[model samples]
Target: MAQITKAGLTFPIMNSGNRHGEVSGEPLPILMRYWRARRNPRDIPALPQTVRRATGLTQQDVAYLAGVSVRWYRQLENGVAADYSADLLDRVATALDLSPAERATLYLRAVGRPPTPYSPLQEDTAECWDQDLLQLFVDNQEPMPSYATDLSWNVVAHNLTLRRWFPWAAHGANLMRWVFLEPEARQHLVNWESDWARPFLGQLRYERAHHPANAALAQLERAILAGSQDARELWHRREVVEHSHGAVRRLRLPYHQGQEVTVRMVTVRPLRTVALCVNLLVECANPGGPSAS
Candidate 1:
């Protein structure tokens, strides 16, 4: 029997049962390094080569687009495991116009973890809604109390009934901002902190987490945190709700003697326009009494 020292640990070598081999004129009962380990033979390869080549963008171009320094982005491309945040990696993925698979590979290799689900490139919040979509909701004869919002929670399309319920949406407004920052929302929505704002905050947090590179969503979060003290405090709570679909909320109906009504919020997304959310409100319970406010 033979022994070897490696990294301060003694490793026992194979005994005479080992097949005979001689090297450097060593004896036939060869002293084999018993604790030998196999290692990855190939070096870490450069990442984003396919994406960068396909986009025909240099490292500087990508760094400029991703809002990162060229040196940092170059290290990222060289497959260096730096302390890059998910947000920055997301930005790089967007800059390279990486496909979902490419982005997954990039994230897995760089960060040792898969990224959040694929998000389509965030569009400008000011983009016009399709005329058909507007007509189907805002101008349609459908009596249902419905409203539509873009990813930024802007009330892009809404009917008279929804406007009647939420007067601010009558024109156009960011719904989450209204929920979090508006004085009127605080007054009308029952349990503003627990019932209304908390879930909305959770939804906001959820969206922002999944779509780290969405500039519009990021701006919306910043605005919410700046304007609402309660939102700022509650934003750190460990909760994340994707949406409030099918949840019943109590609210004082607009211009209806401030009638307290429980409405079930039904949220639906358009297949063609995946970023649009159409929310329909069904009055589930209407306790006839003076408003809670």
Candidate 2:
């Protein structure tokens, strides 16, 4: 008699004294069976259903909730080897009503354990960061300003050079907030209107449009609109910035006697989470500003 989860399986899951963090077979078969059982809820246990169709989600329902196509979700349930993003998996787990332990197990099976040890007590929405990969970028970009941002444009990870270049980054998280509301930003960023604020404000607007339901982003937008009269006026311009890659901008670095320097922004997305962005600022040798002093 095979069980999806064996009896007496405690936290820090082990397979009958096997090595810690080791998993047997793939994880989706269990989910596939779970989905099947949901269609016939009597097979598992009794549960009240408002609608007569079923108690839990159908494949289409899961696809809708997780923002995937039903065909894709069907393949996933059928144990297809697909490179799904962490965010997508979490969304599916939420739709599946998976416990923290089950979520952790699924993650373990899909991507192996994250750089950080698996924590079964984590919340359903929690994401597992590849700390080593984040650290690798930070370490490799020594003396060069590079940082990673989440969906909210918050500086989730950064290198020493980033902190050195913009001291505000040391404590002032939420890069969007800094760009919009921080006084220090206007001082450091050259041409506070055309060069800095317009582009960033456009990006904020674009993100809000893309993720209208995101409360954090909505709150950030409201705060920016309330805090800066400039933001309000520019936001009405109705511009949208899709991406900033290869975009040249000018700023006053903390060092070099606060000299105006030209930098180009290059953006990359990690495989673990496509929504997260990593930006590396490369300074141009020739400062192309009007007063390239």
Which structure among the candidates has the greatest TM-score?
A: 2
Pairs in clash, predicted candidate 1: none
Candidate 1 regions exceeding 4 Å error are: 1-129, 138-141, 286-293
Give the per-residue lDDT of model 2 (tens digit) for 192-224.
788778888888888778876665565567556
Clashing pairs in 2: none
- Against the hidden reference, what TM-scores do the models get? 0.54, 0.55
Q: How close is candidate 1 to the true structure, as a TM-score?
A: 0.54
Over 1-293, each residue of candidate 1 has an lDDT whose tens digit, in order, gives: 34445566554332212224211122111111110011111111122234224323455655665668989876666434456677787676655545566556556555555666522335434444575756576556356688888777888788877777677886668899788766788778887888788888888888778777786687567556644567878988957888888777787756668877777788987666657788887777655543221
| Full-model lDDT for every candidate | 0.62, 0.65
Clashes of each: 0, 0
